[model samples]
Target: MRVYPEQLGRHLTPLAQCYCLFGDDAWLIENARSQLLEAARQQGFEERISLEQDSGFNWNDLQNEWQALSLFASRRIIELTLPQAKPGADGSAMLTGLMAQPNPDLLLILRGPKLAAEQTNSKWFKTLDNAGVYVPCNTPEGQQYFRWLDGRITANRLMLDSDARQLLATLYEGNLLAAEQAVQLLALLAANRRVSAEELSQYFDDQSRFNVFQLSDALLGNQQQRVAHILAQLKAEGTALPIVLWAVFRELASLLQLKTAMVQRESLAPLWSKLRIWDKRKPLYEAALSRLSLPQIEAMLALSSTLELKLKQGGEEDWTLLTHLCLLFDASAHSALVDTRG
Candidate 1:
């Protein structure tokens, strides 16, 4: 069975014995995991929960924990976190095989960041898709985001009037984590009082208009300052270089797909929605499509390929090359577009 984050509230009642959760947005996936865990506790699975990370993961340890069950317990829950699950790797291979014949007595939950675009259509991903539930945590949009906010409000046992809800939505945009936190703060502020829209700012001063989505949008908008600011924040947030590269590559790949489909006389709108790109990213995507042709995209991809190899091979200049690569791509997009116009 497959479930979306929007359907999670009701669909979680019938969680299968195993699940594979992965997507671009981290907050949504983490939110889904929490909700599922709470539901499991309701099903009397509190004490049986076990967690594991992907790095230095011991197959024996996982198998042992999963296979063993308390004589007194009805079911065991195993939650595995894979920060990165590349295709053909040992972890990905083992998981692909395990999902083929998941343990009936155990509820195996796998969480990971979005697979690289190149790996999206891999056999392992296909296997997971075929074998069990997949909750893709791509960024929620528009009314879906409002609905998600309402769900979170209700979950936290708080009340917000219609106006208040709309205000909160506008303030936080699509930032799930920040929105949830802001609502929690509101709940605390109005512990026994009914919160209204007017009182929102009084309780919390929300000051974020450029989140990850906006940063991506800035790149598309060709706003170098905004992009630079975002990159700095990303660095401060400890975002991995590989993760940043993956996101940029994925976006570029999607644009290439959209461009190809457009040339083929197919609809690009559906692809945009399916990609779960926020409204702010539309201009960015448009700009990128205009700025980069197929050949340019291929060139950038080739550059990333070389960068990846160099990083793996190791050297003092690897860091310098990575910085240069990011700058070169950034400059290429802006300069190439300008030159085309000139």
Candidate 2:
């Protein structure tokens, strides 16, 4: 049976013999897996085995491990982490065969990225679905993202006013891990007190641990100095280049889409609604969009595409290229500021 991540907790009591937890979100996937493991332990699954499916991984090994008797515990939990989410013909057959006869003593957990629709409809997947639970862990965006943040704040026993929540939602937009850490930090520092937008600024300034989301915000908001400082910090901390590129690409794409829709004389309400762009963020996008022309946006998109390829090809100048792209925003914003001053 298929289940949502939130519903997994209740279903754990009458645990299925097998479960497939698949998604692209690392945070959600890890969180669900951790919960499942804890539930299995509570249900007397005392012995645990973990297998990472990678190059040279043998399907036969899974069978061997599954059939092997554990002297230490009567019940066992087997975790298979599939990075690619593709099980070859042989692996599929093995999995289906294993599920043919459900063993009450063995609990199987398969974790991986989001599977293609066709993959989900496969015979082996059907068998697993019939015999176990399938939970999706897709990353939440827009309102869903805000609800998640609200839950995190409540769970951490920290309170944030409307403005503070909006600020955080923008600051840590695509990075849930960072948002979680921020919530924890707030909980510790605020001691369950309600925090406002102005108060939160101090935490960010003092912490000096800006993430990709913050970098995107700074770039869009035309905070040149802040952007430069955050970029340097990210490089020093060895943040992955791909992550930074992803944030930049996402923002550029949004602006391009919005600009296109506006040019066509279409109502922005529908477009914003479809994009899941909340009221709080509408102003930010509008401000950035007003400053950026279609040609500039297109140029940036082209640059982003080239940078992505270069990064993939293991280019030595990847950092230099990324720095240059970031500074493009800085230069544009600086020019606008200078023009206004004159």
Candidate 3:
């Protein structure tokens, strides 16, 4: 009876007696719950009693509501919102009791935060899972995220070249809600035609709340505290780790190429134009080359490649390690971070 948000089928012409929607992705969870409510309403669930489960919640009220006749509608939806997804002893027993008894007139919806494995295995959850539909709405990552994005794109009938797709992904990787909004905008602006990355700037602005481009400036300028501050803001604001990683890696690659060219005593002006490092940001790169040795840049590039690969391969992010990687741009902190393996 378990279903993902995508597979909800808009389920229930004849509504299910009970439903459990739980997940970390608030957007997905909310959408799923709305589907259930709409489906329930279509099938004659005209009255809904929403109860927020807080410390002040009384289990007795739930039973009384269920037992008491609904003056408004014969068929009713009793939704219990468990903020932490954990219904303690009294709530568990009440839920189990309700499940044990069949009430054709009453529909139960238990909405909660993400489910841990232990909660999934619990007897009460087991009974509910068996009796009703359970939807796990965890955020998609890696290829799953791309698939989700592709689905969105296809739904909107917008064509994006590979570079355009990657550009879109980089712009709104972690925040799917924002990504969807961006996709909607693209549908309105650039639908039915393939677009390249370079073409995206005519319409799309950087959607990252923490301003990912600023991270590049901070890193290359060797502003250690500013880099840390921006990084912390990105993390706190739930910016995807991959987006920040992409920015840092691009700067590191540019630095490597420029530093190599400098060592060869070649003309740097043409290379600067090719690399798109104009007058304003040229000094930052120059300063970076002065501070970091060629080997150091190469080493950081290698580590960054490894980190990005780990993410692509579905590995958990190590934020502390990423913070250390950004700090590597500061020659003063680089040695200590390298020694401590930060």
Candidate 4:
């Protein structure tokens, strides 16, 4: 009886007497609810009633609603939104009783938050589920996240190459509502054309208040606390993970290059100019180099590479990796973390 949001349409046919939609993602749950209502409407479910379960909600009111006849239309849909996702003793008995004696003219829909394992295994839930459809609307993550984005793009009649898709994904990885809005804007402005990665700038402005440059300065200066603070701020502001990764990766690579040349006793002036290390910023690099050896720089570079790989593979909590990579510049902080783990 369990159906995913993607497969709801296929199973919705023949129209089950009742449906239970529950999830952690409000957007997904709302979307599924709309789909179910539209299907009900098509099958002559002209009259609709909506109820939100609250502190004062009475199970008897629902029973009365189910028993009473609707004058506006013979076919009716009753939607009950459960904010608690918990139907206590009274509500449970009522639901099980109603399940045993379903009204031929009524289409019941119960929408609620995600349920715990114990709740799912309860007798009342199992009974209700046996009589109808149960759709879990959890948000997709990792590769599934990209698949959802791609589906949205196709449904909106827009074409996006791989780069453009990645760009769109980065812009709204955690903020699905905003991502949906952005896609709608794109559809209205320019649908049916292949969107390049570079063109995304026209529609969505940079929403991040803090830039990665600040992070770089903090890292090279070996300011561990400032690095952590800046990373947290960036994540809070919805800064793209890849943008942050590239900036840190760039710094790590540059440090490795400079550290290697210094170990080989190479000339500093030409190397500084070639690496685009400005005169004012030379002091920061020099100060960092004073304490770090070749091995440390190489190790940092390896860690940066691992971070990049994780980002591409869709690491959970990418901000943590970003924070770790940047803080590695401070040897004391890195050593403290190692000691603590020991």
Candidate 5:
């Protein structure tokens, strides 16, 4: 009964009696909820009673609402929004009881933040999972994000060449909502016209300014100044710190894996293929691998973890930590070049 966000649409026509949509991505979760609501409406669910879980929320009220018949519609939709994803003992008991017997007259939709493994494995959650569909709404990363962006462009009926797509991906890195808006804007400005990278650049001057991918490339290419400048630009643009950390951590992780493989005298072709690394990016990985030793990569990863901890502890040194990480890559590349010339 578990489904991904993409697969929720197909299941909507043949609606389940209940559904649980949980994740950290607000935009995606809301969109999926909207889709479900639309599907419910089409399926003759005319009455919707929404309940937001506050401190004063009573579980008995939910039971009452479920049992009460709606005069307007035979089938009703009950939406329960749990902001914390924690249904206490009473709530859990109520949910379990409700799911014990299927209610064909009512559709129960539970929306909430991501549930921890323990929460998901609870008896109440297991009961719901067996009875209804569970849709995950986690934020996409890397190629996943790219595919999502491409889908959005296609959905908007916007034609974008490969370069244009890459540019758009870079422009809206770590911000899917912004990416969606940009696609809509492009669709409006370039109706029935193919948008080239040049055109996209001209139209989205501010958004196209910088991206974390570019920063990663600069780090690998030993462009210290460019990396610093991009970091500053990304910070000024309010790019999420975690997004930047993820990009750098990903590159470092890739380099570490490749370096370890090379040390083991393993052919990298099959490994890269297994990793699903594109041929175009293979050279970037190669360049970084050649420049960074395994020990250096490990040290960088440890520093990255420290940065994460600092952020978690509410430290204001995010930019400082990120800048240091970038400079570490640049320094390693420069050191490698110097060693080669020696």
Candidate 6:
């Protein structure tokens, strides 16, 4: 049986057999593991959860451990964390046989990064899928993510007005786990008080690690002073170049999405709720929306891709690329769009 993170909340509690969780989202996988471990404990398998990683050990040795039963406990959970699993000859043979007759009282979990279709259909993958539950954990996106964030806020007993939530949504830049942590921390920080847009902005501007959203927000708001300041702060804080590049790319993607939605006569107001754009930054988004068109935003996103490739290949001039990105967004905000598709 396949399970998504969205359905895990409901489906997990009733699971009675061996299972495997496989997904790219580390946070979701970890959370799922925690739930399973807890549930197994409640079901009187307190000492069943055993963790293993693929890097240092023989798979057969670990397999044998899962084959053994606890003297005092009726069931056991064997968690194998292999970021990338390649079954050696011995491991492959052992796993193939194990699949034929899964231990009735032992649950086996295998987790790793995302796999291509070919990899997903590999011997071990198919074996796990057939013999036990395979929960695929993909990162949430778009409206699904917003719903997740809103749910998190409510779970924390912190009320986020639509605008405040939107602000946080934008601030998180699609990193749901980080966003969740930030909200939990904020809830503790403002115990017994509701979070506001103003409060969020102050924290975002002051404490946020540099990323695409921060840079784009700085540029969009026409805060040249802040932009310079943030770039310096990022350098001081030792943020990696590629991480910053990814964030910039994410911002460019959002801008393109925002532009496309607008051109389609889609209501930008709802996007605030969908994108989790807070009230304070809605004006900034509105201004950027008012100025940029779909074509123009797409062109800049194209430029971003080119720059990203160059940066990845040890392109000697990252500062130049950064300046160019800033200038393109700046130009979009100013005067009318030039037909620069040439």
Query: Runs in model 2 with CA error above 4 Å?
Result: 205-342
Per-residue lDDT tens digits for candidate 2, residues 1-342, read: 998877788888868989999987787888888998898888889999989888889999999988999989999999998888888798899999999868998999999998999989999899999999999888776578788888888888878899998888767755677777898889889984789999997777322356797787777877776677677778877888888899999988888899888878777888788878889778878888888777677777777887887776766437766666666664363343211111
**lDDT tens per residue, model 5, 244-331:** 9999998888888889999899889887977778887787778878877787787788888877887788654578767877888854
The better-scoring model by lDDT among 1 and 5 is: 5
Which residue pairs does candidate 5 place in steric collision? none
Tell me the RMSD of model 5 versus the true structure: 7.4
- In angstroms, the error of model 4 at 41 is 1.1
lDDT of each: 0.67, 0.81, 0.83, 0.80, 0.83, 0.68
**Model 1, residue pairs in steric clash:** 220-284
Ranking of models by lDDT: 5, 3, 2, 4, 6, 1
Global lDDT for candidate 2?
0.81
Regions of candidate 3 where Cα sits further than 4 Å from its true position? 205-342
Q: Which pairs in model 6 have colliding backbones?
A: 163-278, 166-276, 166-277, 166-278, 167-277, 167-278, 212-247, 212-248
TM accuracy, model 1: 0.57
**Model 5, stretches more than 4 Å misplaced?**
205-230, 237-324, 330-342
Clashing pairs in 4: none
CA error at residue 254 for candidate 6, angstroms: 20
Name the 10 consecutive residues with the lowest summed lDDT in model 5.
Answer: 333-342
lDDT of 1: 0.67
Q: Which ten residues in a row have the lowest lDDT in candidate 3?
A: 333-342
Q: Write the per-residue lDDT of candidate 6 for residues 61-86, one digit (tens) a residue.
A: 67667677687778776777666666
Q: Roughly what TM-score does model 5 have, to 2 decimal places? A: 0.71
Q: Write the per-residue lDDT of candidate 4 for residues 218-302, one digit (tens) a residue.
A: 7888878657766877887778888888888787777788888888998777878888999978988988888777777777777
- In model 6, where do residues sit more than 4 Å from their true spots? 49-56, 191-193, 203-342
Error of 2 at 96 (Å): 1.1
